[model samples]
Target: MTKEISFIDLGLSEEILNALNDLGFTKPSPIQAECIPLLLEGNDVLGMAQTGSGKTAAFSIPFLMNIDVNLKAPQLLVLAPTRELAIQVADACAEYSKYVKGVKVLALYGGQRYDVQLRALKQGPQIVVGTPGRLLDHLNRKTLDLSNLKGLVLDEADEMLRMGFIDDVESIMATIPEEHQTALFSATMPAPIRRITKRFMHNPKEVQIKGTKQTAPDIDQSYWLVRGMRKNEAIVRFLEAEDFDAAIIFVRTKTATLEVAEVLEKHGYSCAALNGDMTQQLREQTLDRLRNGRLDILIATDVAARGLDVERISLVINYDITLDSESYVHRIGRTGRAGRAGRAILFVDSRERRLLKNIEQTIKKPIPEVALPSKELLEKRRLAKFTQQVQQQLESADLEQYQTLLEQIQAESGTDLETIATALLRLAQRDRPLILPPDPVFKPAREYRDRDGRNGERRLRGDNRESPKRRERRDVGEMDMYRIEIGKENGVEVRHIVGAIANEADISSRYIGNIKLYETYSTVELPKGMPKDILKHFERVRVLNQPMKMSLVAGKSSEGKRGRKSNQPESDDKGFAKKRGRPTAPKF
Candidate 1:
């Protein structure tokens, strides 16, 4: 077995070790243990590891220890892919260098004015972290001095490629001194990245830790399908029903943080909004309250929650799904820490299925589906909790004075004590009702389409090898025949009906069965157990610019071979079925 490596084994200075221990970390992760030694030894290193795998510490620890604080001419520089990541890296470095004196770290990213960054650069910080584009801009303006730079780190190199910054990254790296120490870290090493590493480094050491699952196994990740417009209500319903100590709900924009929090507060939930607009003093106080269990829910934007570690957060909700998969991973990582079981819930629309699938593929785990809690289930839970609270209060209470008062009131008013007690209980519970009104049912609206113009079914569509008798009598399997108003008379084609139904009901064409057209109407077969909402939408589908007005065709069930006259068209199988006890298809 491999021996466990502690922070001391990496030969970190006392200041750095003290910072790590203060943060409740004793042992170093595999990548950290492997890369720290080489980084401290002044060797160029290339690391391949997944996000959230202690990659930041692997380089930051050594970069902080080796920097010459007095020179203050950018001794260490880290390039990140996104502004969020830039801030996160800078924050982690600041924490690691807490005990080390005179190590000035500045984060430069876009969105803030250039003048702000220029002012900070004039201070001569020893370490700088920024995005490729922003860093290149600073280099072009000559505001950032790289003459004394000894170490350069490229963080999330593959993410930089995906964000179309590889050329910019190359330009920025080219400006670094030839003899500077370099390190490149990426989740994936594409061909271009490998070529860059070979061209830039001088016999660098490679440390690769295979992509381990970042999401903790203790987290129960789930998603609830909701409409785009009704997301607020859906989230409120979940919060009302689920038992969570504290939660961090993530939104897309800073404005949305306040808006979502206001909605939750309106619905009687204790919530606070955290965003970039807040002052630093206010943000720290908000965080302190959250950590001390005074805050129940916190609505925050992505950037505002960077490096926020709170153990009391038992749940994380993705109110708005992020386009970047890494952001989703980072948002959910706030919970399920320190071996405690946690829950992550994502609210998504039916049209966002592709996004959901992308997240699952990126995380390498399937998030199970969770339905909204029903009214009955919520009521049962509320009643049980109320009963438990009452039981506890009664067990510890001294009821002597209250019992004497109750007897006096009963004697004076000549009314039973139970009646007075019931009235008082009702008054006490008026502010927050134990039983809430039922929430509206959630239904997703999405369409399905097929590439082939045929009836949309994937079955064979070639010349019939069987005789007309055999073709007419073909088994329908376990399918239900339904009638549509559009037919040959309305200039309706098979593709038109297939497209209309597929797009309206969001059902695949493969699920559709045999279709027979008639002069007045048409008939199509579909599988059993279709969703009720989907079926309801199908009745409103328009084919050839007219409502199809579909409905179930009622009749007796037909079995065995269908017998028909030789002269009749094969499409006229409905008549033979009608004569028997079976439901008939539309006549040709």
Candidate 2:
């Protein structure tokens, strides 16, 4: 049996080793250990690994290290399949280059200023990482120089082949100096990629890493069911309560990383932005600050955050669903590394649940479902964290100096011990209001009406729904009462209940009377003695699929006329059964 070697023994600079230490990485991943040495010798290489197998770093590190910064032109180039993937590949290069000095990494794709890319190109990046079309566009315009190219990397080669980039890749490869080292990495080797690799280079080293596409095992995974409209706010609330040392929030695009980060910052989070648009220097600074705790949350596109590992990152949040299982594993792998336990919380909407199932099957484990943090729970969590901060600082305070001041304050105010402590705690929380704004009124929860056509849950009814300006609750005058299993937000219609009773109970619509909708359940009026048989069938009748158990509304209604009512069931937490919504835009 042979022993595995470590990354430090692989001839990386001490700085790279140190950065790896800070990133909580010790040994090179199999592909990295295998591919790096060969590629460093300036040989063309063919790599076969699954998605998320650390392919980006395998090719990027070699390409980045071999570049000539003195040339003041692109010495190495990487072509990615999509705009997001391009940005991600560029970000990976920039991250790996942080310890490698003077290596400028630039990303070019659609949706940004072309002139900006031109300017950066003119400024002389040591490496250009871009999508095929954009890279070719620059090559044609003569804005990008391939004269000094020393390396070329085709990342996700099969994906590019699938996207019809094989022809473009061939053309771009033709433009680069034939002497340049070529590296192609893909999860699958299609006929075209194999053909491309065969034609593009001399004998190439091939290293296939096992489980490269497999999800990291250290991450603790869970999910929450949420509606489309509630997702953003729910995510914000989760961030509020979560005890993240430093979190990386993955979105889909360079643009989304910025936009979402902007929203988080506006909400008073200590956050920083990372994307392909950032210069290599700025990208390093942002990462450095995060490592040093100058930043608490990092918002980034997956491309922008590739090859990024922060030891302090105890949490990984997938704000938007990635399109593939490979990307899903990659995003959440940012946390729970290096013998540390990590938590990955995925916010899933109705449409994205299918992705969740797909991930579960791929991972071969069932990820548990969790509920959104309730408003009250979020407040309690915030307060507890705030108090802990104060306690930690209080234990470290200079007692002699502050104690003297405190004595004087006690003497002057004649303050009791409890009074003084209360005052101090109050002062600590004054600026930091633990009380969050009231959560929006959610509709009542439904767990299906029973056989008797009654809801199993009680609706948390009235005085909660947001109105133009909430009106004062009127005292109740009871009318003959009836039951509705559906509550507000269930698409409950007075007419639906009226029609159900009018038809099933053989009761007139006029006698059906007034209706009220609550958080979990609704109530309506019914005429007395509508027929025992009719009532029996009526109890089993579903109004909007909710049981129509005849009973007086729980809350008092206008004019005390409580005919008769019985308990149906308490409503579920509001909004549990709202109709499914559309697919959400992946957090880029």
Candidate 3:
């Protein structure tokens, strides 16, 4: 039988080893064990590993060891796909090099003020981590100097490719010194990544960690089909009935993290939000509080919660469904760690049923659909908890003073002891009543089963009649028609409109209604009362290389406007419509 390798056997420096010990890392993971030695030997390595495979440390440790802190130039550069991931990688590198003197790390990404990055760059940080677009921007502005680079790491290469940053990646790589060592890590290797490795690396060593994509067997997962209630209300009901030590609630956006955290805190849960917008110090403080049991629920996005391992997290709630199956697996993997049993609950919207099926196929297991806790069940649980509190107070608390006061009150008021006790209970539970209130009534969305016994919903086509039930449930009357300047003439299709709206607005396709395509413009029906910020964001969203200059139509419906050829202007020889007097834009 072979023995496992410890961090001590990896031949690391004392400072590095001390930092590892402080972090409580006794043994290296499989990828780390294999890549650390090769990386330290000045070799270009290609590693295949999933998100939580410790690949960050595998490359970080060797890069830190190889850099000469005396020369305060950029020696190690890591390019991640998202701002959240770049910040996480920088945080990890900073932790690993805490004991080493004169070593600094800086993360540069969009949404952060450029002045902050400029000041950090002036400080001569030896390590730089950033997204490819921001990195290219810096390179173009001559703000970053990589003349003496020693090592380069492409973290989550597949994700970078999927996000259309491969061109920016190749452009950045072209400027770097050819003699520098390279380490590329990804979950999957597509053709573009393979081509780059062949062109840039010099006889690279390959390391593949098997089974990283598999979900933990100890996790019991289920989904609650969002029907009759809003997501936040359903979450509160679930928490009222569930018995969990600690949990992490995953959302899709930074704004959502704050919103969900606020809702949970209002319900008297000890929770906090972790997102990329927060400073490094604030993020660390939030995490420390969670670890010390001061907080029980953490609301976060996927990137914010990456590589998080907490033993007390016995539950995970997916407040917003992930776009891909790999992320779904990673979200639930936060729980059920160290062989402890964990429970994961997913909140699925009606429009997301197809995504749910994709997740089931990836895991090769069925996630049973569950209903929200019944009002009766919640009432019983609350009463039981109140009773338990009373029992504990009676057994351990000193009640001699209170008992005398109670007797005096009873004697003066001429009330029985039972009546006084009941009155006191009412006073004690006034802020949080023991009895559950009536749940809000909402009409359930209908679903149609296809020939294959699969549940699905039809998308709104041009002028398709909607059933009265669906119309009332979805509030079709509240939707307003808006015109965009892309249509069949620009090679735009129905799927393009749906995909753009769904991805960019964080809105489900079900909410989008009739889409009519014309020669130069198209109109779509969207729920009214959209926030000004969301409207502003949509203007920047492009479809088929053209901005969706979206504007509200003059009337509520586009029924008559579609066939009004007399009101439409003619097109020029260049296939462009001539300018004409437009209707007054409506107020939001």
lDDT of each: 0.72, 0.67, 0.76
Off by over 4 Å in 3: 1-3, 213-218, 222-380, 385-409, 416-419, 426-588
What's the TM-score of every candidate structure?
0.49, 0.47, 0.49
Residue-level lDDT tens digits of model 3 in 114-176: 655776687788999998888898999999999999999999899888877889899999999
The residue pairs that clash in candidate 3, if any, are none
Q: How far is 37's C-alpha from truth in model 3 (Å)?
A: 0.4
lDDT string for model 2 (444-539, tens) is 222222211111111112112212232232212233345656666555555556555544432234334456677667766443333343445566
Q: Per-candidate RMSD vs. true structure?
A: 21.3, 21.8, 15.3
lDDT, residue 367, candidate 2: 88
Q: Which sections of candidate 1 miss by over 4 Å?
A: 213-219, 222-363, 366-384, 387-407, 413-419, 426-588
